[model samples]
Target: MGQAIVVTSGKGGVGKTTTSANLGTALALLGHKVCMVDTDIGLRNLDVVMGLENRIVYDLVDVIEGRCRLEQALIKDKRFESLYLLPAAQTKDKDDVKPEQVKEIIGRIKQLFDFAIIDCPAGIEQGFRNAISGADRAIVVTTPEKSAVRDADRVIGKLHSEQIEEPKLVVNRIRPNMLKTGDMLSIDDICSVLQIDVIGIIPDDDYVIKASNNGEPIVINPQSKAALAYRNIARRILGDPVPLMSLEEKPGFVERIKKFFKLG
Candidate 1:
């Protein structure tokens, strides 16, 4: 049976949607049948991030309400054959979805895809619970700021309460330079507080915004560092032993030279 994974963050604007979109695309590229569900309800953006906003005719709300078949609600990606998207209804409210309905839908999709990745809404409310109810695994996305870290801790607690064990952490928008200068929290710092295994570390790359604007996920670009991070996270999810990427804390050509040598 395929696993249902929920990509979530307690705080808003922590790159949860971006990570979900890219991870789904990366998993599809890795030859896995992947279905990404946007469970943000009314504030849907995964459709736009995956570049399928205009193609969405039927959405999650429609499927649960029996307005359309699951296949009809699913939008296939243009670039990856194994990739699909189940967008949320922007016209509906969060209360439109019940936790049981979301679980049933994900359970149905699990049989058809290798991975069902749910892009959870921010906060620990009804939308969040609905998104994570069916997930076998959970990935918490957070930044280095104090508020984000605090929210991550709360999320970990909630996951445990929900019987979701060891939900992995993904520290997004990390600036190595800031970390080195003591201006930001390092990966170690974040992990130390969260007390969970670090599954991915994504840098703050300008390419991410550029790719989002163009309606293409950075993971498809291949040349982007953030894309590489997302791909590594996918491999990790699949039980591959890819080494983690180094976040540049100190600004200089010395570390760059060392990184180059290591790559070579």
Candidate 2:
């Protein structure tokens, strides 16, 4: 049986989608049968990130409603034989999905794949509930900013209430120099507050944006530090003991400003 993981963040713009895309790709690279599902409903972008948008004729809605079979909706990636994507319907709203429906879909997918990665929408609403409904575990992605961390804390609390055990953490968009200069939160700080094991720590690397714009996830590219972080994360998910990346000096104000607008 496969493990279903929901990658979520309480706040938007915290790299939940990017993490899902790269992690799914990374796991496939490691030889696992992985199917990533975009549960964002109306705001479907995981297909775009995975560069499989043009290939998506059917989506999760199509399978849930019996308009298409599960295999028909799955878009296989060329880079990895085991990698596949189940995109969300761009026309449907979050309310169009229910927790029970998500559970059923995940149950079916688990029968064939080794991992089911759910790209959860931001916030603690119905969409969030739908995303985590059938998840055997979860990875909460958050940035180093105060608001993002606060929202992550809220998410952790909600997960506890739902009885989801030991949800792992993925601290994304970290700027090491900013942490040294007291401009951003450190990994230790975020972990201390969240009180969970850190599964991954990805730096705020500019290469991620370039890779996204090219419609290629960084995990497939060997030159990206962020990609290396994600690769290590995939290994960790498979119970490998890999060393964590260290945060170092960050770029200056001009470079930092330039990095903010880059899409990743």
Best by TM-score: 1
Clashing pairs in 1: 176-248, 176-249
Output the worst ten-in-a-row residue range by lDDT, candidate 2.
255-264
Q: Candidate 1 versus the native: TM-score?
A: 0.94
lDDT of each: 0.94, 0.91
**Model 1 regions more than 4 Å off:** 249-264
Tens digit of per-residue lDDT, candidate 1, span 199-234: 999999999999998889999887788999999999
After TM-score superposition, what is the CA distance of residue 129 in candidate 1 from its true location, in Å?
Answer: 0.7
Question: Residue 66's C-alpha lDDT in candidate 2?
Answer: 90
